[model samples]
Target: MRGLGDHLTIGERIAFYRKRRGYTQEVPAGLVGRSTDWLAKAESGRRRPPRVDMLAELARVLRVPLGDLLGQSVLLEDDNQLDDVPAVVMR
Candidate 1:
């Protein structure tokens, strides 16, 4: 079976937020006092979820609500089934 890692691609979502906020990995890394390579890993999902502090800093630097970064909207209302899941989404 595929590992849990294969099923979760928060990196893509993180990349989306990063681009929407007009930041490259380097810029946000500078703001959050982490190395650019570290940021790259996080964006690529090679690293697990960043610390809450880092997430907050990234959200502020990107000019998006923290909830957006955290995906709060989907957390409560949906199963968040992976795209590969056979189930369908319902309203």
Candidate 2:
């Protein structure tokens, strides 16, 4: 069956998550300090994808993992593995 994740490009993925999170196009653009026109072009694939740093910011504004925007999400099949995750101290 066709699904939300099916046949999605990077741009479409951004749009999908933005909508799922109840954000208007302008909302994420504004939060990322970019113009709606720029965000529109990104969502429509009229321009090259944003640079990695900018994409990271966009992911942050959209409240999604950077990997999701970059299409690198990995699934942990075992929930118990969460206990194995180590906490990190950021300097």
Candidate 3:
């Protein structure tokens, strides 16, 4: 099966994870100290990806590891699973 990280834009990836984690735009935006409109613009590709510093906070709010949020290879300690997920490079 194809992973969520495949061939998706940064905005799309963010939206995907956000939805997978069961968070509305308002919930994560508040947790990450961003406005709902900012998250909407980001998810819609109207704005750039969040800053690097904010990525960690976003991951935290979304209940995923930083690597997962960044779409990088993440090592799962419990099962020793390694996922080679492609990252969406923000311009």
Write down the RMSD of all candidates, one decimal each: 10.5, 7.7, 4.1
lDDT of 3 by residue, 28-76 (tens): 9998888999989988889888775687688778776666656565556
User: What TM value does model 2 have?
Assistant: 0.71
Model 1 has an lDDT value of 0.61
Candidate with the larger TM-score of 1 and 3:
3
Per-candidate clashes, comma-separated: 0, 0, 0
The candidate that wins on TM-score is: 3
- Candidate 2, residues 1-91: lDDT per residue as tens digits? 1245547666787888889899899999998888999988988989777776777788778877666776655344466221222222222
lDDT ranking from best candidate downward: 3, 2, 1
> Order of candidates by TM-score, top first?
3, 2, 1
- Model 1 per-residue lDDT at 90: 22
Ten-residue segment with the worst summed lDDT in candidate 1? Answer: 82-91
Worst 10 residues of 3 by lDDT: 80-89
